[model samples]
Target: MKTMRFTPPGYGGRRRDPEQVKRDGWREQGILAVSVDDERLTWPERELVRQLGDRLYGPRAADDGGRHG
Candidate 1:
């Protein structure tokens, strides 16, 4: 008898595609913009936007209030 471990597909921290990463960056930027400028995001949504911005650009990413190229 052999013991087996289940591993999900794309596991082991597979790198995200570059284009997908770029799109994600753009989406995060949009979310942060709406949260800060339009007051559109709920608390949780705003937190999520902040986290995404930190991940994509760094801590300062959200500081500009989503104004970035």
Candidate 2:
């Protein structure tokens, strides 16, 4: 399973690269997507994963599945 390191801004009082953060966040979401289905995780954990996905990717309409609608 792919895993993403949870390194947020201000880690060790250092500056961050926006582009890198975006890339990492996307990868993190992909990993979380798989992790969310893991039976080992509790309900709250799964909920948190869902919330993160929502926050990172935002809501999607049925017709807006990647193309101009």
Which sections of candidate 1 miss by over 4 Å?
1-37, 61-69
TM-scores of the models, in the order given: 0.35, 0.35
State how far residue 26 of model 1 sits from its true place (Å).
8.7
Off by over 4 Å in 2: 1-33, 60-69
lDDT of every predicted structure (CA atoms): 0.65, 0.63
Whole-model alpha-carbon lDDT for candidate 1:
0.65
- What's the number of clashes in each of the models? 0, 0
Measured with C-alpha atoms, the lDDT of residue 66 in candidate 2 is 68
lDDT of 1 by residue, 1-69 (tens): 986587678676568886577668778775223343336567787777777867876876547677987
Of candidate 1, the 10-residue stretch with the lowest lDDT total is 31-40
